[model samples]
Target chain A: MRIPLVASLAWQDYRNDAWLSACSVLALVAVIAPLLVLFGLKFGLVSSLTERLETDPATREIIPLGGGRFSSAFIEQLGQRPDVAFAIPRTRQIAATAQVGTLVLEMLPTAPGDPLLGGLPVPQGLEQIVLSHTAAEKLAARPGDWLETRFARQVAGRVEARDTRLQVLAVLPLEAFARDGLFAGLGLLEAAEDYRDGRAVLALGWDGEAAGVGEQRVYPAFRLYARGLNDVEPLRVFFARQNMLVSTQALSIAQVQSLSRNLSIVFWIIAGLALAGAFAAIFAGALAAVARKRRELSVLRLLGFSTGALLLFVVLQALYSAGFAAVFSAGLYGLAEAGLNQLFVQVPGEHASHLLAHHYGLALVAVLGVSAVAAACGGWRVARIQASEGIRDV
Target chain B: MLNLSAVHKSRGAGSQRYSLVIPALHLRAGEQVAIVGPSGCGKSTLLDLLALVLAPDQVGRFEFNQQDIAGLWRADQQSTLARLRSQHLGYVLQTGGLLGFLDVRGNIALSRQLLGLKDDGSVARLADQLEISDQLGKKPSALSVGQRQRVSCARALAHAPQLVLADEPTASLDPLNAERVMHALLAQAREHRAACVIATHDEPLARASGLQVRRIHCRRDSDGGVTATLGEAG
Candidate 1:
């Protein structure tokens, strides 16, 4: 018989036994919907947690534990590391302290691509500076304001003070840094170091001995930040191996990583169990249907349906059953997904349960593949019946 | 059209063994032939052998539609046999054998649909001629035994195949309904211009219906088994 006739025969048989079809489809749905909802929960929770860490600059920052002599070359090489996002030379803690409008604040070196700035304007000019929110509030200053960024030094056995007027370029947001500090270019910090060392500073032109500012400049330390939360722990360990302990938020990152791993393991175990159950139920059902519908198969054989045609008919019925179950299961999962998101509304960031279109497509493909194999196993039994059985005794 | 010089089939083993022998049978298009005998005479076995569902134990020469049926059987070309069966043959069973999933209309439409033939309106005409037009929408379970027999007859001839095999087509009906069903089946087969072979125990009815009868003669064999043979009578 032709394919349409054979396929219609299969369709007729499927639709004719409505109760049995409904029961099998419901059986498949019972397994598939829960699996989808479980996977969505695992994916959604991990994504939101990771995104929370990923969006914060503090998680991506790594600062050295103690002050040490770090040469300009060392700082440049640190910047070359793939995990480093922003790095600049830092002066000694004592020399880095400065006063702006009667408020003493730590001066940190900064450049472009500084994650701490969070896209705020960088202080590139020698006479420009960016203040942290706390420092700006303490000094009652804002961007475009001028102030005397003053420093003290012992010049020839005499305590002396020097000041340079600089414009405030911008103020870092409170989320970037809660402490009182000012961000200036590396040149300003280098000039401060030079002035404290009693060397002639061309940028500020202080009264001291002439020296080349570029001759083997060595910094006491460097400010560093990682590219991402994942890079922070690795970079910290890397610096730790060199006897330099770097500070990072590695504890929270490790906790989130372990949580994601555990949730994934749970999801896979449950999904595997559900898949096995669905496979067993469908395989047994298709096998029993072959036995129960022996008379109808024999009738088809008598009607000149080839053994191959009959097998196609059986598989077609299975495909329809699985396809319907996949669609209905996805619908049920959608409903459950909404409820889950609503339940977790108090938690921050992305929905509590979510899935993409391709995930559902993959699930459908897997269900169809398993159903086809199971049905093919049952269809082979239909071939053993001969055409004469329909009329042998009757 | 079919021709068989000698085709022998055997069933069972030991004491319960029975055998059927068709010495010679010839048929042409639009002809009606009846294989009549009492019960346990292997009438259905002969029909099965003719339908290509049973391989002959022995064959002198068996040709169907000018093809070597005995050779095809020997070669075990089951797929080819199925193709030939679907393309050229129709069957009517005693119990109506209508698929319960399909309505009366779907049951009748199966034959032509199998042949991939377009609807030639013969289904409606056959239902009209068989007087089951009103019952076409109903399922086989809902119809009377007589009405089911007519639906079976319509299905068998709806595609106008080369041959129709009717196995005890009226066995489950009353006497009046049996006669009516038998006449309706024969009349539809004639209208489709197809040769038919009806297997039944009613020899008198076969004669009354004007069919050429080949009644099987049975006797005890040398092996303590029953042997039945079919040949032209009168």
Candidate 2:
């Protein structure tokens, strides 16, 4: 009943019944390999999707609604909130146009770190502008190119305007925004305000007050971003409490979370069923092995092996088979992961394309647990063999 | 050394009862005894009882090596009996009872391995004595019937137990093989100063093997009960 003897006997028996032992190992592999691959894919894909969501500011974008002016201090206060990454005031200009000799283009005020800009730096002064690729092509301008343009605004049934020369600081790529518009700094808004008040020499003189005095300088709207997707809901609630309307992609994120949770549940259920089947197969195989070696086991009993020793012998056989199966399952998982990644190469977005090492470790532990239980069930039979049975069998 | 007196073992109840009774039996070191009986006799049953594999319903006295071991059959003494079996006794079954998975050398050395004893070249020496040296690396299934029987004998004597029990050790062998196996078994048992008890139906062979012969006789009574008794042969 010594461990060495049991091990030697178990190994010898394994070699003697190579086909049956191989069958048991294959059954374990059949259950473990696919389960590991599935888990690996799920983990990989979820991680990739999470990475994408984190990197894209749009997922955390918050747009404040209503067309009214708010003080610059209000925008600054909103930006200071812990949940807010950045908040920029936007003014809606009526008939705001830029004329470069014979070419005319619409101008929009933009802020630094705006998602629409695709990470392009914002223009820092009234002399600087960021042109869309299409707009730049139309104007025949590149970075550091000076262009002359005039801003016009209407008041009291008359047009008031001023001409300004601006330098193109950068051109937005197609991925940044496909639309044909010029992005300008707050300086442009100041120039527009000056023209609206008839302060420019080219404007028709009128007796109207300056637009940016006190509360009258409030912006029509503001673009806001959260530090992270998890902060979106809290920021939305805060904005709503202030009677301010906010827009975000929280609903899409929630939908994806729910789908991922459901998929995980389904995957575990299938894995559980597969493990149960594997347990049954391994248990049945152990039982069959016990029955086939009944005489041998009885002889061991007669040779002074205790029931515990016999049980150990049987358990050792099961562990051997499980060990082999786990190795094979790992190899098969590696191959399957490679094949799946290759198959999904053309798919867009972040793809979980490889099995993680920890997942493989977890699979090994699971297989060992399953095999141990099954082997114990089988070893119980060997433990029950009476020593006298050896003689009776003879 | 072994001793048994007024031991009783029975199977079934009432009308279907079959019982075996041994009034007294004794064996000393270096003694060889063979229980001879025809089929349907309790020869194997007696062997099992003496080997402590089958528990007797009651016993007046059961001693091994001058220690009263009759009470050792209690559940509490199970481990004690197992230890004794491993350290002090050996067994050979009728069909050789060799584990097919192990090679000849492994099979012969199993008892020594279980007892946690160093080999001391006993298995090799025994194999040489039994002319099974060439068969040591082969599995039992690869050996002939006679060769397998010799390996079983070598296994029984490997650990040098104080008592060796063999049930029909040569039941399936030809006359020549039967003589050769019995000769080797008895010679080894004597050389090791071990008491040996063999059960067989061949009375002539049992007597020729220089073993004190005892016969087991069974009779059915009118009430559908059977009784078995053991006594010395004439």
Candidate 3:
């Protein structure tokens, strides 16, 4: 009952004092709306893309870097790392030339000893090639065609690989390679290049395997794998430290999403500043109210109120106003966010959670802090009044 | 019971020193006293001393209800005096210090609430008697000066304090309103069997009320002393 008296009096004061409350609401809306939207979209996109990356394993090491070569020694070294689960050394090669019919054709050759190459129509005991759907269209070559491949370093020089021939075993799907085009085994090209250079006399060079030389091996790049997607970062970092050019497509995507969200945070900051200004105005307004009501506090003292009770009354009043304002602001923000979402499809999905996570607690803390500061400023004037001051003015 | 003997209060020290004195004044329970004075006299100061708001720099055996109040510690003194004031004394400041935010009814209710009085009927009855009942729903800002003064009286009497102190309650009112306020104040003080002390310069209003009156003269000799003229007129 006693508490209600104090609480009711405080509520009455807050309600009757409209201008300050309006200012406070305006400031709160300004700060909180943008913070919610910014934090919301940031969390939304980051989590969404992270979800997709975490789900797939094939795309984990499909890094587009260093002209598409998977080196064996690098794959061996990557497999030795604790985080790397499986490293596959695969090479891609592109040999573009003009055919006898004056038509341009691109050849993609594959390694000889790969397990996945067994079912293809490449001629038995001969190194074979898989052609892309588009590459197959221009080559005018079938599954059994003796595909003559040409290689030339300078246009003025003779076409040296005009005599090299192979069979196109399979027409691979168009989507087999990335949208940038071009896919093949780097080992086959190396073997073919060795033949043209007269290294075929070495006997071990044309087969795409050097047998047992460790230091003489070269690979375009290594396709590094991991136990889980999270394992990729440390593995990537390890290779990067070795001066290997590395890229984390997933991380980059996350960063872009975060950038978009961070941009919104600036708007939130402005809104927050507005709320602060409004709160400052609230403090000033409440202080003015208290100043005007000095005689009332003196009256309470005259009616046997303890100094503690007087102070309690003031603090209670402030807390009541601040608490009510916080609840009101949260509801207002929620409604606004919902309405805005309906109007704009680009409104990120996770915005509400982000807003609640970051700004809600902050607003609560700020409201209380501002309320307390206002109470202290206002209480200062009351503490100095002697009981006689009330009656003397009358 | 309230008692004061050789109470002294001074505004400043030595060269600028001025003292207020109330010599040998006593009031039993259920007694009303009117303090009348000219301007610059220490009537309000005497009331302040009695109210225990300002302590005398020096004292000669001043007591309140047989308690030696002269040597009480600040906390102990405030508590003791505040307890008495809450349950037994009502004060009406000269200018009707009604809180601006509260409506007339709420202002009247504040005294009872502050004093921890549980009764609502007493507050309502006082509001009716002070003629502030019709204005109860309106804030102090909506009321005229006279209406606010009436609301102040209603608040003072609402808690039924045993002692009521009115410092120039009629100072801001015209003759008719002053008479109305004085009559309401004196009538309520009698009904509650409370002792009421009013400090005022209005001689006719003080005389017409027909209560026991005391006149105070602040010493002009620069020592900050008040000379209490006892039982001046009744």
Candidate 4:
């Protein structure tokens, strides 16, 4: 028989045994549907967890363990590191804290592209400050509001209280920082540390002694945020190599990464077993169909259907089942995914369970490949059937 | 079209062994011959050998269309043999052997389709000649036993093969239907200028159909086997 004839014959016979063909399709669907759902859940879970870590300012923060001498040039170099999302010199912890209206807010030095600012403009001068929501609430401050900030320093033998008023540049959302803090430019923080060290704050002209006492600007630590959670551990390692210890949210990052890896391993194990079962089902179905229609196939063989043609005939049916099952499994997976998304979503239409378009395409290709191999195994038996057998029996 | 000498085949083994021998036969294009024998004889076996399906155990000479068929068998040219079967030979079995999936038209057109030949209207023409024009749309399962036999005949001749072989083509039909099927098969084969071989147990029917008669005789062998021979009528 010709290839076209064999293909048509395979289709007709498959239609003739429509019930049985449907059963085979369902068997393949049973194998594929769970695998798709499992992978989708794994992918979605890991993706969202990783996205949450990536987007959170706290997770990206890398805090120096203690104050150490760091030069201005070194801080510049630190800012250029690929893992460093934002790096600016920070004053000693003692001087970093200052008093506002019934609130002690830590002054963090922020520069351009600071993730904490979340696209908010950096404070331009010593008088401008970005207050965290809690700090703003505590001081009852809003943008354009001026608040008195007090910092005390011992000058010679006297403890003097110096006061400066700062205008709030912006109010940061709680997701950026939940604590009592204020974001300001480098000059304000430097001047506060200078005043605490009994040096003149020449920029503010609030002097005790001159800052040009043969000293260049230097910092004890840096305020840094990593590019992402993936950068946190590496940045911590980089800091340690420079003899500067840092702390980060590395543990949480590891937990999420490990969860993703373990989930993948489990998914693949289950998928492998399911695929093996599917292959067996396809193989047996192909073989049984051939055996059931042995006389018909043999007659085809006698009528000049070559071994190759006969093999094509049998394999075509198996492939049809696999192709149909792949499509149906995708549909079933879609339904299950919708149900799962609705079941677990925090908001409607925000699905936690999902699969990309390529994933469905990959599944179709894989099922077709496996079915072809399995059917070819069954086709091997068909290829061996003697045409003489067809003549004698029929 | 074909010449054979010393063609032989065997089935079973030891105590249940059955063997068949075709000493010699010659046929030309459009020639008609029938192998007439009892049921236990090897009439079907002879047809199978001539159809190139049953390979002869040993053949002194077997030639078809000036090609060395005996050499092809000796060299294990299976593909070549299958090609010969498809392109140059046709067979009608006792059971019609119609694929249940295809209707009567599909059944008849199958042979030409195998050769990748476009519809030369032979399927419709054969259906008309076999008086199965009305039944062309029906599946073989829907046809009566006699109708199925005629469909099988149409399928065999539709390709206009050089040789047509029929093994008890009317075995399952009533007497009147049997005569009709036999006549149709012969008429189509002759119309197509095909060399024809019919295997049947009914000698009177074979002679009445104007087919030159051949015969097969079987005798028990000393080794608990039976040997059957085919040639001129005993």
Best by DockQ: 4
Model 2, C-alpha of B229: deviation from truth (Å) = 2.8
In candidate 3, position A382 carries an lDDT of 61
C-alpha lDDT (0 to 100) for residue A387 of candidate 2: 77
Q: Choose 2 or 3, whichever is better by lDDT.
A: 2
lDDT of 3 at B96: 78
- What would the per-residue lDDT of candidate 2 be over residues A245-354, giving only the tens digit for each residue? 87888887777677678879989999989989988887887788778788888887777777887887787888888899999989998888778777875545555556
Residue-level lDDT tens digits of model 3 in A272-326: 6765675576566557756766777777676666665666566666676667767
Instruction: Identify the CAPRI category of the predicted complex in candidate 3.
Output: acceptable
Q: What CAPRI-style quality would you assign to candidate 4? A: medium
lDDT per residue for candidate 1 within B169-223, as digits (tens), equals 8878888888998998888788778899999988888889999988889999777
Model 1 chain B lowest lDDT segment of ten: B6-15
What DockQ values do the models have?
A: 0.63, 0.58, 0.42, 0.67
For candidate 1, state the interface root-mean-square deviation in angstroms to 1 decimal.
1.6
lDDT of 3 at A385: 58
The local distance difference test score of model 4 is 0.87
| TM per candidate, chain B | 0.96, 0.96, 0.89, 0.96
Q: Give the Cα-based TM-score of candidate 2 against the true structure.
A: 0.83
lDDT by residue (B43-117, candidate 4, tens digit) is 877877887877788888899888888888889887888899999988998899899989899999999988989
User: Which wins on DockQ, candidate 3 or candidate 4?
Assistant: 4
lDDT of 1 by residue, A1-394 (tens): 4888878888888998999999989998898888898889888888888988887778877878776778888888989989888788888878887887678899899898888887788897789899999999888888999988788899779998888898999999898889999899988887888889888787677878788656787677787888878888888889889999778899999999999999989988988888888878877887888877777788778878889888888888888899999999999999998899998956655878888889999999999998888888867788888877744433
TM-score of chain B of 1: 0.96
Model 3: per-residue Cα lDDT over B1-234, one tens digit each: 777666667675555665666667778776777887777677777777776666766676666656666766334567676676666667787777777778888888887776566775876788788887788788888987788878888887888777788888888889999999999999988998888888889977887887787777544454443343334344
True contacts kept of each: 0.62, 0.67, 0.69, 0.71
